[model samples]
Target: MEFILDTVDLEEIKDGIDHMPISGVTSNPSIVKKTSPEDFFGHMRKIREIIGKDRSLHIQVISLEADTIVEEAHRILKEIDDQVYIKVPVSYEGLKAIKMLKAEGIHVTATAVYDLMQAYFALAAGADYIAPYVNRIGNLGSDPMELIGNLQDRIDDDGYDCKIVAASFKGVEQIKNAFNYGAEAVTAPYAVLKQVFANPNIDKAVTDFNQDWYSVYGEGKGICDL
Candidate 1:
């Protein structure tokens, strides 16, 4: 499974990307707001600069109207190139907007999906990616793994170019669940990604290494292992 960093702080993400073992970055309005309550567009500009023109970046559009979303998609993409992915919801307006964007060859991620049928419908609408939130499904006491399995097989059997992006991951177990089912990508928080390196054995190894490393080299790699 490919890893995507779920963060809006471009500096933090860029600083860590070289060693983070991630392929890309994901940011919604919520994550953007957390980064700066009053200047999302400005933050996005900084992000584009940090990532450069050819690197991939996922940015969610806030418009609920098809026309507005379409317009926003073009504007965001114009910031760089095709590497930019516009995230739209799975509403009727979003479907229309995504189809239009796709027709123009813009990468679209259909978000806010909660069911297997919704994911299928998004692919039918020609979305390049479909994001199904695992934490949301699990909060309703439903079997998210079952949905992941079903969608994985359905997409593979149909040979759709559209991919499944497991979103809103809660922990390493959830990440592993999606990976085991062959999710094309996973967008999880810094905390969740950082947590993946933290098992009892891993922690013991780290503790032992830290103690032995200073004697051998006087410093560690300064990487955030946990």
Candidate 2:
């Protein structure tokens, strides 16, 4: 399973890659607005440097038309690298764009997916990754896990090469459930992922273990010191 970071913050990206099993980095316009980098392409290049070409970097296109979306995807590849995944929303125009981009052998990630039909359409259009809005689906009184489960079944039964990269998580449980429902990947904020180790009992257990070790080896001493 892939644990992708969903932020544009350089420090968060660095810390996450350093401390966790981060597989890739994903960003949308809103996420970019948070950082508001002076040079957009330069900032993305820095991110590519941090993660390296081995990891995926997903960048969304702002164009609403299929022609412009294709143009933007080409420009993003030119500005960044060809390895960058072009994130296009799963709309009528977006589906068209996905087909066009895929025809050129460009990586395409279908974002803003909220329904099974949208995902099916994207899958048929050759999207490398289909992003379903987990929390947003739940907030709309629909079961997000159901959507994920059905999508996974389709991908398995149909033998599609696509992956479900679930997004829009509000908490750790949402991310957990996304994986449990058969999502191959889930992108969440660094803060939400960090909460996995935020339990007070975890800290308490570590403190108790250290205290027992100190009682025998003296405080502030390591095994190497012996």
Candidate 3:
């Protein structure tokens, strides 16, 4: 039931962490390209300051080879903080890197997972978190929820410590579905997550309650005022 943000925007991260019970912030190369910060490591450090040490910060590697990926991860850990989780795509080389990182007691989040087999591989490789691309999977004509559910079942049955961190959401419903299907976490855009409170019915209910209280109290008189 962890709600994570999928962005590198500092202001949005601050606002989201301030108002929401966000577990962490996750960013891939594509998301980082949006911000294009002049000081990459500095910007990441600032993010850590905002979220504090309690929350997790996931940073993806830019290399394609197994050794290079491991090297990039080490550099990121050295530059940022070692507590940062390295997000490696679930590929042939990425899986190799995950095993190596996990052997070193480094946190590894296996990303770009679109199928159950990929998730299984990542889980077996000791990934702390397995990220499944929900929207993209659906676009590929597969039920992403089913995949998440299956993965959850496997984790529960085998006593695996790995968690499913669902990603690539285009709508809030998809995010909800991920949770409903047993995803331990779901990372989505700021706007998509904020839209949960966008329903007019919620606002209307709050406004009506306030109006009734004002009518009885004769205005400007709250429970505290009384």
Highest TM-score: which candidate?
Answer: 2
Task: Sort by lDDT, best first.
Answer: 2, 3, 1
Where is model 1 poorest over a 10-residue stretch in terms of lDDT? 217-226
lDDT of 1 by residue, 130-224 (tens): 89999999998887778888888888898889778899887899998888887888888887887866679988997898878666655654445
lDDT (tens digit, per residue) of candidate 3 on 52-129: 999999999989999999999999999998999999999999999999999999999999999999999999999999
CA displacement after TM-score superposition, residue 63 of candidate 1 (Å) = 1.1
Instruction: List, residue by residue over 1-226, the lDDT tens digit for candidate 2.
Output: 9999999999999999999999999999999999999999999999999999989999999999999999999999999999999999999999999999999999999999989999999999999999999999999989999999999999999999999999999999999999999999999999999999999999999999999999999999989998
- The per-candidate count of clashes, in order, stands at 0, 0, 0
lDDT of each: 0.82, 0.97, 0.95
After superposing candidate 3 on the true structure, give the runs of residues whose Cα lies further than 4 Å from its correct spot. none
The residue pairs in collision within model 1 are: none
Off by over 4 Å in 1: 206-226
Off by over 4 Å in 2: none
- Higher-scoring candidate on lDDT, 2 or 3: 2
